[model samples]
Target: MPSSRISEEITFRKLEALLAFMETGNLAKAAEALEVSTVSVHRALHSLEEGMRCALFRHEGRNLLPTEAAHVLADVARDVLKSMAEGIRETREAAGYSADQLKIGSLYSLTIRTVPQVVIGIKTRRPDLQAELVLGSNADLLYKLKQGAIDAALTGMPEPDPEIESIPLFEDDIFFAAPADSRFARMEAIDLRLCRDEPFVSLGEGFVTSSGFMEAFRIADFTPNIVMKVGDIFSLMNLVGGGIGYTLLPGRVRDMAAGNIALIPLTAEFDMKQTIGLSFLRRRERDPNLLALAAVCRMTRIAR
Candidate 1:
């Protein structure tokens, strides 16, 4: 249809005035209801009637009487206005702007302490709020944050990125982890060179711990013998506990497994630290929901 033929002059404000006038059946009352001057109300209805290209009112003596066409348009306008408001509200919520629920992504290890503390603190502060935890590796979590699949992320902070906003919560040292019954458990600290020939079960490619594991060995000038690679942290920890092979882990997992696992410190030369942080899109830095989450993060730092 041509734009000229369509009611291009029709607008929500006109529809609102039409509804008010239709409800009150008085020009002064409609103006008062809309918090506008009587002249504004008259102009709105006049434009609406002209846009509709029909007789919406008829003058009877000194008063204006609404025609049946006006009543029909009022009913439809009411529905349209209500639906528009609902659409805007739902759109905001779908974009993670809702205060009723928060979607938080994190490294699987942080679920042991840091993630839980932040979740609890935020919930306590916002009593009506609900939280969802999405656990993955560091790479996985940061990818989700960028994709807007999660509202915030708790993971090992990456080197500075322009698009991401990172709030460093704490530094968690990487430890040389092995079975409790292993001979290395009795040692004061782990020397990576001694374990170069030792078979290792590692958290696979995308994990932050996996990168730290590789870096420590690289600093020690040796390549670790790889026995297996797993997706999640828990599985790697289980492998270590079952005497499968030695692996590296962050301090957050120190007490996660039973006494079967021992977390020994790394030698000075092989020292590596994973900085855990809360991260989101830099554009959403001032969002109320994100600000509240940041506040909780500020107070919920987990001690290694």
Candidate 2:
């Protein structure tokens, strides 16, 4: 029978060691799992039994057999340890550290250099911050921002929205990009109307680039011979590099312009640029994680 007299010598760690030993049914195996010496595991179990003033185990030759009292204690120990872990997690989340992961959203095109800069800057400021990037179009990123799925978004800045707040990072011009070997590539500048007969690959709807892509052609007063539509900017770049079709791309992606692709300037009449910014929900503007993100954004100065 177990006594009601409890000892201050009992500790959560000793109970953990006891649970490990009871579960494994071997002292060496328990120590190996806990990454401790076998002697340490044996000592902890001995202390736990002494603290509770109960016979938790008995020796059988060289092996040890757990008593019914040990089984009951181990069961309670399992629940207690699990609850403690959950409580710690809840505490951290309430303090505004999201399991240490900072989820951020951005457009596919900005991944070239801008997103990396922000991620590195934020992590540098918060060494414990694990920056996670989620890529999508302007619409997709904004949707995630409002849904509370991401801490902030690096995307093409939209007109002032009542539900959101933004800080402009930089501006990038939309340029006509074609295969280097194509006839239009040799031109220093291109007229949108001249490319009406040429095949084009566009970004799907909701993309900021797609809006500029369509608006440019609309201003020229003729629909382009659009050959295909793709989801990501990298894929669009690949297709253009492969000579699939010419498309409008932001100057931020100029690093990707090497051998196969040529980025030609758009004529003044059709020239357009996108303002890139860091956006977050208006309600959560004061959130510590969002504030950290805004601080990083304020420090950024990306030249056009």
- Count clashes in each candidate, considering only residues at least 3 apart in sequence or on different chains: 0, 0
TM-score of each: 0.77, 0.68
Error of 1 at 281 (Å): 4.7
Candidate 1: stretches off by over 4 Å? 1-5, 21-43, 54-68, 90-102, 121-130, 144-151, 159-165, 281-295, 302-304
Instruction: Quantify all predictions' global Cα lDDT against the true fold.
Output: 0.87, 0.87
Where does model 2 exceed 4 Å of error? 1-99, 302-304
C-alpha root-mean-square deviation, each candidate? 3.9, 11.7
Candidate 1 per-residue lDDT over residues 136-197, each given as its tens digit: 88888888989998989988888799999999989888888888889999998998888868
Q: Which clashing pairs does model 2 show?
A: none
Q: Clashes in model 1: which pairs? A: none
- Give candidate 2's whole-model lDDT: 0.87
